[model samples]
Target: MNRVYILLGANIGDPWQQLAAARLEIEERIGSIELQSSIYESEAWGVTDQPVFLNQVLAVSTAYSAMECLDIALDIERDLGRVRLKKWGSRVIDIDLLYFNEEIINTERLKLPHPYIQERNFTLVPLVEISPQYLHPVLKKINKTLLLESKDTLTVKKHIHEHL
Candidate 1:
């Protein structure tokens, strides 16, 4: 089995319900979720005029390759009403493939150890919560270190505490 980390974000519709539904779809379509961070609420990253988004990082156990995982995640978003209106536009659901094991991959459709991991507080905080020691394949820094070094000033507040 291959382990992958994914980020789920939503700012439209019932955000909590959207996340729950996305999680279910991911488990069914992608793989078994071994670990998930508590949902974090933050201001929109790129498009600042939009509503706040609820985001979470999930560690999944999958048998699929990186591109396959990306395909499945994109399908889940489409099934759950994600539309490409504009860059960083508001959405019902957004799934970003953050990391696929320790392997470094770069393709037109996917990028491993997501290019923005070290720069976003919203992505870093929950990632640290679940796997603080997970190292970035390219940067060679742990999640906690990335979080500390992050220049993103966005205030990411934990929305729901997870038991596991």
Candidate 2:
């Protein structure tokens, strides 16, 4: 099984419920979920004019490959009403693959260890909450340490909402 980390976020139409719904759908498709971080309330990252997002990271073991996993993630987002209007646009739900094991596979659609995972505090904060000592495949640094030194001071509040 391939160990994968997925980041979940939502900011529209009962954001917390949408996030939980996505998680339930993921469990049905991906077998079992290993670990999940507490839900966090974070200010919008790129597009500041949008609503604040509720984010969380999850650890799972799956039989699918990296690209296959990406396909599944995208499907879930679409099923949950995520529309691609613009880069960093607001969405009802967003499912991002943060890490896909140690494989460094970069294709037209997917990038391992997510291209921007280390840069955004919203992603890194909850990621470290689940796996504090996890090491990045290419960066070779602990997840928590990266969060500590990150220049992103965006407010990331823990336990923003209770998990369903």
Candidate 3:
């Protein structure tokens, strides 16, 4: 099985419920969830005018290829009512493939070891919570280290509730 790390985010229409539903869908469609970080609230990344996002990181073990995993994630987003009207626009759900078994892939449709993992604290912080020591395939740095070094000024606070 390939070990995959996925980042989940939502900012519209009951984000907590959307994430919960996405998790269930992932478990049913992708693979078993091995580890999950607490949800985090952060200011919008690419676009600041949008609502704060609820984000979480998940570690999954899957037999599917990376492309297949991406397909499954896209299906989950569509199922959750995601409408990509604009880049980084507010959405009901956004599921990103962060890492895939330490492999680096850059294709038209997918990029493994996510291109911006080192620069976005919204992605790094929760990732650190679950996989602090996990090394970045391209950067050769640990998740926690990357989080500390990240220059992203966006506020990322851990949500107090445990349900999501």
Clashing pairs for model 1 are: none
lDDT of 3 by residue, 33-137 (tens): 999999999999998998899999999999999999999999999988998899889999999999999999999999988999998999999999999999998
Give me the runs in candidate 1 sitting further than 4 Å from their true place: 161-164
Of the candidates numbered 1 and 3, which has the greater lDDT value?
3
**Of the candidates shown, which would achieve the greatest lDDT relative to the real structure?**
3
Ranking the candidates on lDDT from highest down gives 3, 1, 2
Q: Quick one: how many clashes does candidate 2 have?
A: 0
Candidate 3: minimum summed lDDT over ten consecutive residues — where? 155-164
- Candidate 3 lDDT score at position 162: 60
Which number leads on TM-score? 3
lDDT of each: 0.92, 0.87, 0.94
| Candidate 1: tens digits of C-alpha lDDT, residues 81-107 | 899999989999999999999999887
lDDT (Cα, tens digit) per residue for candidate 2, span 1-164: 88889999988899888988888988888646999988988899988999999998999889988788888889988988889998897889999898887778788888888988778999999999899898888889889988988898789998634445
Distance (Å) between predicted and true CA of 32, model 2?
1.0
Better of 1 and 2 by TM-score: 1
**Residue 68: error of model 1 in Å?**
0.5
lDDT of 2: 0.87
How much is 89 displaced in model 3, in angstroms? 0.6
Higher-TM-score candidate of 2 and 3: 3
Off by over 4 Å in 2: 160-164
